[model samples]
Target: MRKYLILGILLLGSMFSYANVSIRSMETELVAVGISHESIKEAENILNIALKKHRIMLIELEQKELEVNKLLIEDPEKNWFQINRLLDEIGQINANIKKNQLKAQIDVRKFISKDDFLKAIELHQMNLGVIK
Candidate 1:
C-alpha cells in the first residue's frame, strides 16, 4: 500500500501540473466525438462523484500523515506502539481510498463505450505527454 500510495499521490499531485484537463473538458470532447449526451452525462456524473470522494480521502490522508509526523517529532523514540497504531489507521484509510477510486472508475466505464474509452485514453496520453 505504501508503494502504491507513493505512486498514486505523485500521479495525482502532478496530474494537474501536466494538463488542464477536467471532467467537463472530457465531457465536451465526448459529445464532440458523437457520444450520446445521456451517456456522456452519466459518465461525467460518475466521474465527478468519484473525484469528490478521492479529494476527501486525500485530505483525510494528509491530516493523518500530519498526526503521525507530530507523534514522531514529539516522542521520536518512545512512541513505537502509538506510531504503529497510526500506521494501521493510515493503512485502513488507504484501503478505503483505493476501493472508492476503483468503484468510481467502474461506474464511469459502464457509461462509456470501448471506443470512447480508447479515445479518452489517447487524449489523456497526448495531454500528459505520454504520447508525443
Candidate 2:
C-alpha cells in the first residue's frame, strides 16, 4: 500500500514538472518551422538573456507559494488571513509570466520571418493536441 502511494505521488510530481515547460519547447518549434539553425541559436540566446530576470521572479514566486501552502497546512486558522495576500501575489506572478512570455515571443520573432512565426503558431496548436 505504501509503495503504491509513493508511486502515485511520483507520477503526479512528474506530470506537474512537464506542465511548466515553455522555452525549451518553443526552441524546438522554431526548428519545426524550418528556421535556420544559426538563426534559432541567435534568437534563443537573446531570448534566454531576456528571460533570466523573469525566470528568477518565477522561481521566487514558486518558492513563496510553496511556503504559503506549507503554512496553511500546518496551521489552518492562523493562516486564513494570508490566503488573500497569497492569491494576489499568485495573480501578479501569473500576469508577469505572461508578459515575459510575450516578450520572449517577440524577441524570437525578430530573428525569424513573419511566415515562419505563423507556421510556428500552427505547429504549436498541433503539438497541444498531440501532447494531450
Candidate 3:
C-alpha cells in the first residue's frame, strides 16, 4: 500500500531528525563547559563510550518523540496525551545528558588542578610576580 509506505517513511525521517537534534544539543552543552583542550578530548572519549552503551536507549527515546509528534499532528484533540508522552521522553533524555555532563565535569576538574600545578611551577622557575 502506498499510504503505508509513505507513513513508514515519514516515521523513520522523524525519528532520525529527533535523534540528530538530541545528539547536537548534548554536544553543545558539553562544549559550553569551558574545559581545556586535553580535558575536552578526554571528556569526549568518555562520552563516546557511554553513548555507545546507551545507543539503543537514545534511539528508543527518539522514536517515542517521533510518535508523540505524529499523534499531535493527526488530531488537535489528542494534544494533551501527546504532550505528556513527549515530556516524559524529554525528561529521560535530559537525565541521561546530565549524567554524562557530570561525569565529564569531574574529568575536567581533575585536569584543572594538574594544569594549575604546572603553571605554579613555571611561575616559580621564572621568579615572576610575588610567590604566595
TM-score of each: 0.70, 0.52, 0.41
Where is the poorest 10-residue window by lDDT in model 3? 22-31
Q: What value does the lDDT take at residue 101 in candidate 3?
A: 47
Q: What are the lDDT scores of the predictions, listed in order?
A: 0.71, 0.65, 0.53
Residue-wise C-alpha lDDT for candidate 3, range 13-126, written one tens digit per residue: 454444334333444333344435565455456545554535554576567767766777888575886678676876776477446545644664564444543453455444
Q: Write the per-residue lDDT of candidate 2 for residues 1-132, one digit (tens) a residue.
A: 435633643553343333234335666776887887788777757666655755576576667677777877889688877876886886787677667666766776677777976677678878889534
Error of 1 at 10 (Å): 3.9
Error of 2 at 89 (Å): 0.8
Candidate 2's displacement at residue 119, Å, is 7.1
Per-prediction backbone clash count: 0, 0, 0
Alpha-carbon runs more than 4 Å astray in model 1: 1-7, 13-23, 26-29, 32-34, 120-132
Q: Considering every candidate listed, which one attains the maximal TM-score?
A: 1
Model 1: lDDT equals 0.71
